[model samples]
Target: MFGDVMGMMGKIKETQQKIEETKQRLDTVLIDEQSNDGLLKVTLTANRTIKNVSVDDSLLEDKEQLEDYLVLVLNKAIEKATAVSEAELSAVAKDGMPNIPGLDMFS
Candidate 1:
């Protein structure tokens, strides 16, 4: 019984390490989004760090419109990045998890 517990503990530690590695990898995974009119564009990492933003001259003419565009495009980018981050992290965690009876958290 102690052996099993020790093995499980090792597996959990391995999983935690993998999770951290995956998070670092995700920082390189980029998600791009643009306004429907293509006037505003954004690029961000799966970690939700903004990398770049491009705004059209027309958008610059209207402060309110630019803000609206930024909101919409940034939200879309964040959503995509969040989805990718979650999927990658979940896969790593689920794959690393030891099969323990009565713990079907991943399922």
Candidate 2:
């Protein structure tokens, strides 16, 4: 019984390490989104940090359109980043969990 407890503790520590590594990897992941017309682009990391925004010089003259473009691109970038983050975390969760009797349904 003590051996089982010790084994579980070791697995928990290993899972914690993997979680930290996943977070670090998320910081390095870059997700980009561009407008359909290619006039605007936004880049973000899986950690949801905006990395860059680019807009066509032609759009600068039209303030209203530029605002729209910026908003649209930013939203797309954030959405994609969120999806990527979810997928990564799900993978980590699956990896970190150990199979146990009658508990597989929870995953």
RMSD of each: 0.6, 1.9
Number of clashing pairs per prediction, in order: 0, 0
Tens-place lDDT digits, model 1, residues 13-74: 99999999999999999999999999999999999999999999988899999998999999
**Residue 54's lDDT in candidate 1:** 95
Per-model TM-score, in order, reads 0.98, 0.84
The RMSD (Cα, Å) of candidate 2 is 1.9
Please, what are the lDDT tens digits per residue for candidate 2 over residues 18-78?
A: 8888988999999988999999888889989988888899999999999989888888888
Q: Which model scores highest in TM-score?
A: 1
User: Model 2: which ten-residue window has the lowest total lDDT?
Assistant: 97-106
Q: Ten consecutive residues with minimal summed lDDT in candidate 1?
A: 98-107
